[model samples]
Target: MNAIVIGAGVVGLAVARALAMAGHDTFILDGEPAFGTWTSARNSEVIHAGIYYPQGSLKARLCVVGKEMLYAYCATRDVPHSNCKKLIFAADASQSPKLDGILASALGAGVTDLVRLSANEVRKIEPALRCEEALLSPSTGIIDSHAFMMALLADAEAHGAQLVCNTKVTRVVRKNGQWAIYVDGSAEVAATADIVINSGGLAAQNIAANTEGLDPATVPPLYLARGVYFSYSSVLPFHHLIYPIPEQGGLGTHLTLDLAGRSRFGPDVEWISEIDYRVDPSRHAKFVAGARQIWADIDPTKLRPAFAGIRPKLSGPGEPAADFAVLGPADHGSPGLVCLFGIESPGLTASLAIADLVLHKVATD
Candidate 1:
């Protein structure tokens, strides 16, 4: 079978690889000049331990399973990654109850290695961290997202998958039990395939809307949540990732370090109307305040505005968080087609698992 996977983000690349491995002639399409340029490139790149998400949700299930698969793949593929672990802590006594709730949720999601740490235990592990209590997630880690995506593309190409860049799919239609994809770029191009998978990330809903024969009501509303990262100039004293209790619509402004031990704080949720990558310098004060909650000695002068990324969210302001939507023929009655929506946060960690699920959905049909 011939298959087409739209959107060349990490998830789309992984899906294309899975399809090619399943004996399908797969074509990976992206509008960007290079792969992983959008949502895939702009993320925390943290491997979640299936925490924070509700049990039985796609985010919880996939993140837990995918983290193991990702670590294994990185090791065998020589992708640079670190199992640096993470500490989700309660900065104050009042937040301790919420930390308990988080621990319960993580345990229910089958994350068995979480260790609850007392104040002294937390200090022993991270001397610079100030927290009443913390939960240590041994499975949570970080990866070089660029290298990871490159490895996935290499493997997909090795399995006979073709990646087309600088091309946008203007329209999709179903005819004669196959999919017709219309592309517009330097030249007008048309391609037919046996299956179509829309993993468009930020543009998923638009792709679904343009897909003929699909129900419009089945497509959920898309909201863009802009998150900005502020790089810290000085070396951080802590080694592991430090997170405060999650706030509404985000995991709070936490600290994450790159492979070179440079720490950065960010991702305060800001609802945006359109796609914008510019980072606002005014948010530096807020970041400083947020960072001071966890680390008492954070230098305000060292905080500099870094790049930002927009999350394709399903829920808007004041709404509850949404689960990852992997709509298939079963949901839309469209044979050999799958639409992915609201794949943010753990989407990176769950890329491989999401690919497997997409392949299974198409194969069983």
Candidate 2:
């Protein structure tokens, strides 16, 4: 089968590798001059342990499976990553029961390595932390996402997949028996393929709306949520990733360290109406307050505006979070068309698993 995958993000690259490895001629297209420049580059880069997501959800199932696959892939490919572990904590007694709920959710998702810790117990390992209770996730860690994407692209190219950058897929129309893709709104068809997968991270909804033969009702509304990070200039006190209780749209402003051992506090979520990457320096006070909840000794002077990334969310404010939406040909009545939406957070970790799932769908359909 000849396949065309739109958007060369991590998930798209992984899917291309799978299609190519399965003896299909694969082509990857992206709007940017380089791949993995959007959501793939702007992230916390943490390898989640499948916690917090509701049990039986795609995020939970794939995250647990993808975490292990990613670790193994990193090892074999010599990609830089670490099992530095993580600590999800409750700042006071009122929030302690959330720890048990998180544990139950993790267990349901097949993550059984979480260990409950008391404040004193946590102090023994991380004296700088000031939490009432916490759950230690030994399997959680961080990864060099850029390197990981590079590896996937290398494997795809090695397996005869071609990648074309700076070509934005404007519309997809159903021809006689195949899909005709147009780029940059040009009247001429850019290419045609037997199978087409829409993995356009941020631009997915727009692409689906522009798809001629697809049902407009199947296109879910796109919600944008921007998250900003602040880098800590001084040395980090804690060894493991420190997280607070989950919030409505995201995990709270927690602390995470890069592979170089440098510290950063981040991802304060703010709902937005448009795409913007500008970091607000005024948010430094909010970051300081959030950081003080975990480590009281955090110096405000060291905190500086680092960067920001917007999430391509499906649900809006005050609504329950949505699961990963992988709409196949069977659901939308469009032959040989598969679309993925709301692939944020653990998408990097779940890249390989998502690819496998897409391949299985392609085979069965």
Candidate 3:
């Protein structure tokens, strides 16, 4: 079987790897000069333990299964990662009930390793933290996402998959029981394959809209939610990833340490009209305020503007969070094609599971 996967992000690479491993000739295309340079690299790199998502949703299911798969893959493949754990805390006694609700939700999502901690227990583990209560997720961790993607690409190439960077798939037309892919405004078809998976991250909807046989109504509107990161100038006193309660459009401003132990606070949700990666210097004060909720002794002067990332969301502000949309031929009545949309948070962690699902859907549908 010949397969072509659009978008060279982590999810796309994973799908390509799976298809190639299944003995299909696979090719990966990306508009950027390299793969995994967009949303895949811009996230907190935290391996979520399936908490905070609605039970039975794709986010919950894929994240739970994918977290385990990711950990195992990293261990065997020598990919740099850490199961350093995470703490979701409540600032005051009045907010402690939220911890119960979170714990219940996590349990429903098959995350049973969460340990409820009182303020004193929290102080014992993290002396710098000032919280009324907390939930310690032992399964939560971080990964070197770039290394992970590089490994996936290597495996795919070893299995006869090819990656073409800067090759933007402008349109896909189903003809003669196959997909004719056009790239870079070329009038002629760039390639043809029996299976075409639209895994474009932020540009996914646009690619679907351009596909000839796909239904226009099936394409969901893309909402860009920009989250800015502010890196701490020095190492912090926290050993675990520190998070507050969930916020609208994202998890609260949390502190995540990279592999080198450099800490950063960030990703405050801001809805935007256009795609922009600029970190607003004025947001420093807002980040400081959010940081103080977790650490009272954090020095504001040490916080500096680091970077920002935009999430290609399906739902808008004030609306309920949307699930990951993996629309195959069964959903859209378009055979031999699968379009993935609203794949944002926990995407890096769930990349492998998502690839498995995509392969199964294309095969069965």
Candidate 4:
């Protein structure tokens, strides 16, 4: 089968690899010149353990599976990553039960290594920090997202898959048991054997709407939320990723480190209407206020607007967190077409798992 995966982000690249491994002639198409220049580039780079998600949710299932696969793949490909662990800190003493809930969620997701710590014990791990209670996650870690994407590309290419850059999939049409893909405003199209997985990320909603024969009802409404990240100019005191127990909508302001050991804080979730990457410098005050609850000594000068990422959040803020919605024949009524929506947060950690799920859908459909 000839499989065409639109979008070359982490999820798309991972899906390409999985499809090629499944004996399909796989090709990844991206409007961008390079892979992961969007959400995959601008993220916390933290590989979250399957915590904070409700039980039986897709985020819970895939992240738990994908985190394990990601670790193994990193080791195999010599990708730079760290199981440096995570600390879901109880910044507010009254919020201690939230931390307990996080532990329970992780356990329900099939992780059991979580250990509770008292305030002094939390200080034992990082004496410079202040916290009333915490849960230690040995499985949580960070990855060089670029290196990880490169590894996926390498594997996909080695297995006879190809990437088509600057090839924007303008429209898709299903005719006579095959998908005809039009790229870059050109009428010239490519025919696929059976499957056409639209892992278009931010542009997914738009892509499905423009497809010549695709039903609009099959594609869910896209909720674009811009998450802004900030960087600390100083040395990081904490060795592990410090996260607050997430609220219902998103993770609160937290500190994460890069492979270079610089501290970056991010993804303070802000709802937006469209794909906007503008980092509001004015939000620094709010970021500082939220971050100080975790790091009391946050220097205003060190906190600078670094980068921003727009999540394809299907759900809005202040609502119940939603599940990963990957529409296949079962949902879309299209036998060989797959559409993925609301693949946010653990999307990176769940990249491989999503890839496998997509491949299975392609195969079984």
Candidate 5:
């Protein structure tokens, strides 16, 4: 049987690897000249410890499972990653009570390793931290995202899956118990198998809209949420990743480190109509204020503008966040087709588990 995985981001690449390992001939399609250049390449490359996701959601489940798989793969592939741990602090003295709730929620979600710490304890772990209270998550860490993606691509290629960069999936058509994916304008790759996994990420809605005979009304809206990051150019005050109490809407700007141990802060969320990578230096003052809650000694002069990434958020602000939508033959009534939407934040950490999910969805159907 033959299959095609759309979108060459972390999730797509992971899916391709899983399908290839399952003895299926697969092709990876991406419009960009390079893979993982979109959301996969941007943001803090933190391996979440399943702290923020709600109970019983895919994010919570996959993050915990994927983190284990990711660490295992990194070890086998010699990929660089660190379990440096993280501290989610309540900078506001008034937010101390909320921190208690955060810990309870995290624990309820199966992150039992998260424990509370006093301000003095926090400063001991992070000598320069200025929080009144915190939650130490030993499972939270950072990874070399590029290395991880390369490893996935290599594994997929080794398993006989092909990656065709600069190749766009223009449409989907069904014929004779098979699905044919149109590329550019002239060529088409037919999946003789009865499964099509759309790991299209941001472009998933458009791909679903183009799916043969899918109800246009059933296609949910895709919201664009832009996040920006900045790097600390000088001496780092802390050894571990530092985060603020995350709101239900977004993970607040937090200090995170790369594999080289350099510190950077980011990912303040902004909703936009289009995909924009602009990092507004004007927001430095706001970041300085927020960041100071964790590191009182953060040198404003040492901060430099960094890259930005936009999430394909399925829900908007003031509304409840949407769960990871992995649509399959059961939901769409179209055999051999699966669509994934609203895959953000924990998407990287959950890449491997999400692959398993899509793999099972295809196999069980």
Candidate 6:
């Protein structure tokens, strides 16, 4: 069977690898010049330990399962990663209750390495942090995202999968039991495949809606939420990722360190009408305030505007968060077609697991 995966992000590359491993001729098409130019590259790069998501949700299940797979894969592939744990703490006594709730939720989701710590215990691990209570996630870590993506792409190519860049898939249509994919960019081309998987991160909804025979009602609305990061010029005092209590539409502005031990804070959620990656210099005040809640010594003057990334959200501001939508034949009555919607935060962590799920759905359907 021949398969085409639209969007060459981390998830798309993983799916292509899975398809090639299944003895299918797989091709990955992306509009970007390279893989992971969007949401996949622009993130905190934290490998979540399946915490904070509701029990039995896709995010929870995939994250727990994927984190394990990722650590093993990184070790085996020589990918640059750190098993540096994370500290999700309550900045004040009033937030202590929320820490307990997060613990319960993480336990319910099968993350067993979480340890609740007192103020003194938190200070012992991260002496610079000031929190009333905290949850130490031993499994949470960070990875060099570009290296991981390159490894995935290399492995997929080794298995006979091919990646095509600078090509935008204009539309897809079902023609006589196969998918006709029309693409434009470097050259106008039309290709046919036995299966088509829409893994387009930000433009997933647009891809689904453009399909000739698909139902418009099945395509959920897309909300673009821009989150900006601010880099700290000074050295970081803590070795672990620090997260405050999650806020509406996003995790609160927190500190994350790259492999070089440089610290940065941010990703404050801002809802927007269209795609924009520009970081507003004015948002530094809010980031500074949020960071100080975790560590009091943070200097506001040292914080500077950095890059930003947009999340594809199904729900809007002040609304409930939505789960990963892996629509298959059961939802749209279309054979050999799968559409992924609203895959945001843990999408990078869940890439391998999601690829497994997509392969299972394709095989079963």
Tell me the spans in candidate 2 whose CA falls farther than 4 Å from its real position: none
Model 1 Cα lDDT, one tens digit per residue, 1-365 = 99999999999999999999889999999999999999899988898899988889999999999999999999999999999999999988999999879889998987889999999999998999978899999998999999999999999999999999988988898888899998873233389999999999999999999899999989999999998999999998999999989987678899998888888998877999999999989988999999998788888999999889899999999999999999999999999999999999899999999999999899888
* CA lDDT, every model vs. true structure: 0.92, 0.93, 0.93, 0.86, 0.86, 0.90
Model 5 CA RMSD to the hidden true structure, in angstroms: 1.6
Of the two candidates 2 and 5, the one with more favorable TM-score, higher being better, is 2
List TM-score per model, in order. Answer: 0.98, 0.98, 0.99, 0.96, 0.96, 0.97
lDDT for each residue of candidate 5 in 1-365, tens digit (9 for 90 to 100): 78889999999999999999999999898989999998899868899999877999988899888988988888999989999998888886998998888888888778889878998998787888777888899888899999899999999999999998998787898888888878776565633445678888889998998888777765779999988888888868688888888766777878899888788888878899988899999999988887776677778888878889889888898889888988887887788788999999899999999999999989977
Q: Which stretches of candidate 4 lie over 4 Å from their true place?
A: none
- Once fitted onto the true fold, the runs of candidate 1 whose alpha carbons sit more than 4 angstroms away are 185-189
TM-score of 2: 0.98
Best by TM-score: 3
Candidate 3 runs further than 4 Å off: none
User: Ten consecutive residues with minimal summed lDDT in candidate 3?
Assistant: 244-253
After the best TM-score superposition of candidate 6, give how far the Cα of residue 164 lies from its true spot, in angstroms.
0.7
Candidate 5: the clashing residue pairs are 194-336, 195-336, 196-336
lDDT per residue as tens, model 4, 71-153: 99999999999999988888767889887677777788777789999999988888877878888899999999999999999
Residue-wise C-alpha lDDT for candidate 3, range 13-32, written one tens digit per residue? 99999999999999999999
- What ranges in model 6 sit over 4 Å off? 185-189
| Tens digits of lDDT, candidate 2, 1-365 | 89999999999999999999999999999999999999999998999999878889999999999999999999999999999999999989999998988899889888999999999999999999988989999999999999999999999999999999999999999998999999988999999999999999899999999888899888888999898999999987899999999876678889999999989998988999999999999998999999998888889999999999988999999899988999898889899999999999789999999999999889878
Worst 10 residues of 5 by lDDT: 186-195
Model 2: lowest-lDDT 10 consecutive positions: 245-254
lDDT pick, better of 1 and 5? 1
